[model samples]
Target: MTSALDIVFAALADPTRREILRMLLEDDMAVTDVAEPFAMSLAAISKHLAILAAAGLISQEKRGRVKWCKLEPDALRAASVWMQSFGQFEPVNLDAFEAFLAQELHLPTDPEL
Candidate 1:
């Protein structure tokens, strides 16, 4: 079975969807306004928005006559946490790595630049 993370990642896989998310970061936008920048038809943009909404990455509501899309920033919490777990490890020291490589190859380490 697919997890929520899987759904979110799938929604984010498309460049068009990622651009839509970036636009929503500034403020909520009408469906038409969101569709304005893209060269594709409104129907195609709507499909991308639908996928984002299904992933919980965005929320859509009707304000008067227009449908507005809002970024649900909290929806990224789980994905962020999962990704940050890898950051817990200490970073590799490049100097140490270079020294080790030199030693393994029986090369002399140059102290002077």
Candidate 2:
């Protein structure tokens, strides 16, 4: 079985997906509303939502004619516990986060090129 940490890592692998999670954290929103803030297409947003759902980071529901997304806070709590255990993750830094994303995405780092 994939661990909660695995779910977290998978859920956080995409920047747009992360933004979706943060938005859901505020409150559940319909699929269209969730996709409205981004330049991407509705399909792209739905794909991100699928990833979050697969990771158990969020849940989806249909009401009448609209589908909504909601955050699963426990998944975040699990991610936090893993971070706390590592003992080196201080206040979030943009550079560090970008580096982490690059690493995750397998981008060739150009330290000097």
Candidate 3:
């Protein structure tokens, strides 16, 4: 059985899937609009979307007719946490860096962050 981490890595491996995520980042989009930036067929893009959805990177919802896709930001958090496990041997404090950025920007630390 494929682990969730494996699913995430596999989903992200495809350039097309990454671009699809980029498109979804701005707003939820129909499959056809998501496929517009690439030369691939709608079917191919649909397949890519399936991979992404399976990995929990995106979720699909149907409203009446067209299906729209939206990015699951929490899924990226899961992926980052998985990858960070490998870097446990390192000394860098990513949280501290994030706080430093927050301080420099004069923004309060994110509660969810």
Q: Pairs clashing in candidate 3?
A: none
Query: lDDT tens string, model 3, 1-113?
Result: 87888899888887788778877889999998999988979999999999999999999999989998999978877778877878763436787778756754467776786
Local lDDT at 17 for model 2: 90
User: Model 1, range 10-91, lDDT digits (tens) per residue?
Assistant: 9988878988998999999998999999999999999999999999999999979999999998888888788878875333
lDDT for model 2, please. 0.83
For model 1, what is the alpha-carbon lDDT of residue 51? 93
Better of 1 and 2 by TM-score: 1
**Could you give me the TM-score of model 3 versus the true structure?**
0.74
Using all chains and alpha carbons, the TM-scores for the candidates as numbered come to 0.75, 0.70, 0.74
Q: Give the lowest summed-lDDT range of ten residues in model 1.
A: 104-113
Question: Could you report the Cα RMSD, in angstroms, for every candidate shown?
Answer: 11.2, 6.0, 8.0
Please write out the lDDT profile of model 2 over residues 15-107, one tens digit for every residue.
889778878878999999999999999999998898888878889999999998999877777778778887867668767866866755567
Candidate 2, residue 3: the lDDT equals 78
Q: Which stretches of candidate 1 lie over 4 Å from their true place?
A: 88-113
